[model samples]
Target: MLNKLMHSPSHKSILRLLRNSMASTTPMAHLLHDTARQHWRLLMLYLLFVLLLSFSEACLFATIYQTMRLLLGAPSFTEIAGFGFTQGQRLFLLLFLISALQMVASMSRAIAGILSGRFAASCQRSILPEIHRYILSLSYGCVSSFKIGDLSHQATLAPLTINTEIDERIRLLTEGLLALIYSLVLFVISPWLLLMAGFLGFCIILTQSWLRPRIRLAALAVEQQRRNISGTITADLQVLRLIHTNACQEDSNRRFANEVEVFDQKLKKLSNLRSLLEPIAELLPVLAAVLLGTVSWILSDQQNGLLIPGLATFVLALQRLNIRLAKLALSLNALTENQPRVEILNQLLTPSGKIFRRQGGTPFSGLKEAIVFKNVSFRYSSRQEETLTSISFTIPRHGMVALVGPSGSGKSTLSDLLIGLLSPTFGAILVDGKDLQTLDLSSWQNSLGVVSQDVLLIHDTIAANIAFGSPVVPSPEAIRHAATAANADGFINRLPQGYDTMIGEHGHRLSGGQRQRISLARAMLRNPEVLVLDEATSALDSHSESAVHAALDSFSHGRTVLAIAHRLSSIRHADTILVIDAGKILERGTHDELIAARGAYADLWERQVHGLSRPHLHKQL
Candidate 1:
């Protein structure tokens, strides 16, 4: 039944995770449904074990009731004699045995829980990489709609919520099942006792229904805040330096503060609401018991009554059970609240329409041929406009080709398309005269060497950074050699640990130039056929720029180079310069040829040189 419901077309497709509930679904029903689907084997095993234990639990409950009855019967002195145990002592011993049984139950539960935990974690481990691969596999158009920070939080942060929920579901399931069984037994023992419980049940059911919508709304609020929080922090941290440089630190701080404050307030409100509801929940059983006692008193005499003390004790048991059932009903909302998050995780785990396989291509296989683009066009999914129009170009075999353009003129878009990071809205790219769409994308891309404006380095050794791109990481000696080629050897050698030194998160300890060099070294270690350098020197000082450029000269030899040059001077010596304007190649030739034509290329070049030379021409471009 659970599997059938989960697979139904009406159920929202699980997203590769996005938020609390999936993009579509009510949380409680979704979580319960999803949990049933996700952990069927565990649930079945747990249920079987619980059923065995319930028999034991029922024996314990039934024994207490019978023992009290024996005491009330007022037997002879032999039964009442306190030699081994008094009346209280006998009952206490039974209670102690029940407590011992619970302890045994707890131990077994721990072992079972550990097994379940390992299973879920293993499933998650297998699923996480697939999630990552899905994100990596998405069309750049689809990916651009997401922020790396938010995705990071979702992939790492939000999934932690699911982990907690998994544990809670187990905890609640046991408690709920035991309570349910115990309550049903109480009702069976004395139906008159259940009369009071019905009132409590009515109250519990009414409250649970009302709170479902509200709890879901609160969960939705919490999820929204969490998603936005990561993005806000990401943006602030990225431009931290700019904040100080422009003296906008105060304003940025205020924005961050506001975001956090709002987040805290929402959390507090949700907490307060849950707390306020607790008393009402507790009073349900008490009110039902009081009503039954009042009616029982008026309806019959105590000495010869249908509702006697024994019956009242039974009613009290049922009342407790009713309250427990009420608690279980309330907890079911948490599952709902967690539904969106689970859907997102499920969606992430779900197979996608976007497949990254390469088409009609030979593997880069020792750099035998050039990278080719037949006719290519691309637009971001979120953005209304196309970033690259129908354009065709090829990087010659082992030759340097430069792409020159004004900002947002499709240079980055082309590089992304060539890398299989984005698919063409309308055309194809080829590697070695074979359609790239037909080849093994990850395997093919594994052979590419790309260096971009963003320099990402992990918290690891300099050696690790230098050998990051290659499928088979180089040895220590190999890492040093690659570093030497990138002109990163000097600074690396100066560090206390030499090649073994760690670079903190974002390579924060290193200078910008140092970080860029390390990134370049990593690419060199890969020893790829296709080399792409996108604005490699755009942020460097002249001295650093020259050093990196010198390193590039060594690296580019015997490789096909695609350079997206920000400073026109850098690409002047390139084998071919493609001047791009409005997502199309406006001019193609040597730098001097483009200069002679005096088209967009000449306009941009003239503006760069003339604008920097004097302030007046800067606005002209």
Candidate 2:
């Protein structure tokens, strides 16, 4: 299957990606190392507490073993009881002391585990935002190159499992190390059990040789199944409303069930492997005990080689070591299986040097300046064909410009460029004639307002959705005012809870027009110098479109608005209309000039005036 995966292009890409990702670990390791170096004091304190817990456990086990031997191997119960005291009070006091020590060790170990959990969770929480920022900051083309489900899987689940390794594996590893030390201390007191423990250790190593990789493979399958399930779930959930409304519920159910069944089977196999492990491991110690018991009985018959009263102590300590070693092996397998996902996540979360962070994000030379595309060109990374070919145009300062074209035209491509979602392949983009590369990317984007045809609203309260990630918090008054400007206030006020009402899963609770208006309101509240409307009213009915256009006209009056619209009527009023087709501008003019000239605009206008006309008919009037 792995060789077949290597042959498949999609999975083959993952292999190549894995190599890049392996190299990528240098920075993340450095990040972890740097953090450790800076917070060595805290780390040392954490280690100290863990060691204290381990030592306490070791001491309790040792004491218990010794007490058991005294009780069992002593010539008489009276002799054992009389060693330290003359009456029953002596044994009672010894029993009480042992119980108290055991309780302290158990409680402290649990406390240390909790502390480790909190520390791991805190570090995980800190790493989360950086991961989110890295994924969010990636270029749109780069983001589109992967499945959305895969990225989300890498972002959330992968980190969670890797953190489990830190929280649990390191803790288990240390416990085993401490137990081995305790075993050594026991060995110092007796030779028979020491030899027996060494023989058991060898047996365990042989058992684990095959056991570890099988367990790791099972775990790997579990993780792979989860990613597939996540992708399927994400894609289906995105259009769940449409699926149910269109009576495709059964189809959607089948898809979900298919993913669930596959994931469940993988999980079952992994669980089965884990179930089989400890039984096989138990054989290691049982075999060791049989051999040691036989050897000890024969040695006891010899005059010089004698049986010790503390034989039970060595046996007890050796048993504890065996148990912990088995657990350590289990943890090591889990860590190895999860390591690949951690590697992939490190790649997704690593920062790219391409985006330039502002030193301080100072104001641009002209915040209110127009945008210019000086011979821009772009093609999606996955596509061989160019989407835009040497496109050049400028929006007049504080003026309205509309990009108009048919399907597959460069209108949307140009919109992408104007919004800085994609950089030009060969030419410079400018704001106030300053190279865009010179300005801070995030700050520059913050200064722009965009309402696209694909109206994406979060599943949150209406007011919260409008506020979104506004740098300045949106007040009730501000939110209401913005909603009114987008002509969404009236409808929103009539909802059961008004602005406090939750949109419910991608705003499915609202109509299409309602969703679009909320998006418009969001952009309006920003009060940006550059307003991008990519078919803002295209999704609305005529009645709703009228309301939206009125709001848009007011918005366009003050700001530099660049609109890409299919409706020719909207662009007829634009100060300049660029007739774009097949990635190049066919013409650029005012409404009347293009109409009289009988260019591409005139044909589109004539065709619209008559009725919907296909572009296959003619190029112009």
Candidate 3:
């Protein structure tokens, strides 16, 4: 049966789509369908209410039409069985019963709203946390590939937007079903009028269909523009101090304004198309009502007996039918409008073979012997040049190794390899005689610590930021001890709130030296077996650097330390110094030995000693 389906053209297309959905992100239809299936009992209950509401609406409209007929004095056409009352009394009682039924229908609708709202909230609760967890689980490369703005939108805003859209679509679906029932009743009243109204509805649908591609394109454009705008706004805010210092605020403002203008233009185009759709959806329905009423009156004149009653029924039914069709059209428009955002969310949430983060390897313990890079090479997917080339080296257990090189010479790339952030493209990294690939990275990471140039702190208490990744929050004494080791406790104690002081965004409230020390304290808090320091103290003043170095000396006694720095003063006591140039280690020796040898490391040392700075000389001096 599966083979036959695969061979059939129509089934092949469906199979291909299913395969695509499985391999990549699920399509919107599948997402909705899956969500509905998860809440099947509640959805079914909601639908029952919707059905009751629709039935009540049909009954009430029919009752009104009957009441009009009896009051207009067209008697005895289709009398209620066993009711012996006069037409006036019959009409009054019937209207009263229909009014009560209408109230019941309203109450049912209210109940359905509660159920749907709860279901929608549940969907949000499920999807938001899941997406956040998935993001955290992604490989460092995958995480870094997305911008902060884009990730923020995906994690924070997209779930809410998607849930709201889901609610709207579900509501629309129920309304559409209700409209169908109304259309059926109208068809029974006057087939000709019903057919004409359906023709108008079909035209409305056709117009929306024609506008779909354009609107969808516009939606995509707007979504992209929104990301760009978000990125721009974020970038501008982050660089505001630099812009002001350089006296380029006008230039920055103009650039941001231009982006905003472009976004505005795109929005205008989208709105124009949307507005065009609305009037067309609305106008045709009104025309249908006018034409149907006119036809009913003319038909009433041609038919002598019971004409008023029939005409009244047809007119009321047509009115109800028009309402349902109009609502259906609007629902479709809303779905189309939200397509781009949904697609963006789908891409973020989708787990694809090509993009999935690697998982499930042998659990790793702390490094016992050494981390060895054997003939390691790496090239980014977007670049032709290899960033690291045959970078063979061994970081001995419980040793301090300094990587000294200019920018773009693969110091950070090599560090990334050491941290298991990037895997070797053409070689293997071994830890304790086992391939890094075989070791559980998460476990390995837990045993590792890092202090980099840019320290990231959340807008929370200092203690929280220092104890960010630990499964359990560090105790106050532990926090104080780590801070003392990092030479940060003195200043932390001086703060208004002491250890409980709230750090502003990225610890902007603190000085550069303070932030760096706090970062060091964070690294120390983990008591990592392996520590990587990439220009960790470059922001510190001389006194602060000395204090931090003293703290690090105590911490580095038994830990494997991989330090990357340009300041020759800091690594004077390193056990081993590797001087890298153009993706290869040209020299490796102790600080004193490399100086005596007068090689690449020697040249860098001399330059730093003389306060001469040359970033990267392609040719050896």
Q: Taking the tens digit of each residue's C-alpha lDDT, what string does model 3 give over 1-621?
A: 111212223223222332333222254444544454455677668778988888888777777767766777654334746557877678778779778988988999899889888877777776677667768777887788788888877677655655656566666767887778778777777788778877887898899889877888887898789888898888878877788899998898899899999999999998888788767876777777777777777765455446666666666666666666667666667767777887787677555632445587988877789988899999986689999999888889998899988888999988888788988889999998999988877888888889998788889988888888864578988988998999998999899999899988878899989998889999999999999999999999999999898888889889999999989788888888889878998889898898898777777777778855345532563
TM-score of 3: 0.90
Per lDDT, the best of the predicted structures is 3
Per-residue accuracy of model 1 over 1-621 as CA lDDT, tens digit each: 222323533232221121232333533234334544465566556555655565556655565554555456533232556456566766666567667766666665566666667646744654456447656655555666668777776677433555556545655666676777666665765566565566567777788788777776777687778778888888888777788889998898898888888889888867766664667667776776677667656765545333353465566566556656755765676675775566555554443444433344545464567666777888776678888888887777888889987788899888888777777888888777777776777777887898988888888888877877679957888888888877889889899999888888788889998898888888888988788899887667788788878878877888888899879988888888987766888788888988898666677787678863323422322
Of the pair 2 and 3, which is ahead by lDDT? Answer: 3
Candidate number with the higher TM-score (1 or 2): 2
Rank candidates by lDDT, best first.
3, 2, 1
Give the Å shift of residue 319 in candidate 2.
1.5
Clashes of 2: 0
Off by over 4 Å in 1: 1-49, 74-134, 157-176, 297-309, 343-362, 366-370, 540-551, 595-621
What tens-digit string does per-residue lDDT give for candidate 2 at 1-621? 111211222223222332233232444444343333333445455666767767776666656655554455433343554665544554565577678877776777776666666666765665566567666656776676779899887767644654564544455557666767766766765565677677777776777776667877777787778888889889888777788889998888898898889889988987876776677667677677667666765666533222443445555666676677767766666665676676565565445433322333445544556678898888776689889988888887888888888888978778777776777777888888887866776787888899999999898999998999686998999999999999999999999999999988889899999999999999999988888999999778898888888888888787888988888887788889988888888889888988887767787887778765557535532
The candidate that achieves the highest TM-score relative to the unseen native structure:
3
Residue 45 in model 3: shift from native, Å?
3.3
Candidate 1: worst 10 consecutive residues by lDDT? 10-19
User: lDDT scores for all predictions?
Assistant: 0.69, 0.71, 0.77
* Residue 70 miss distance in model 2 (angstroms): 5.1
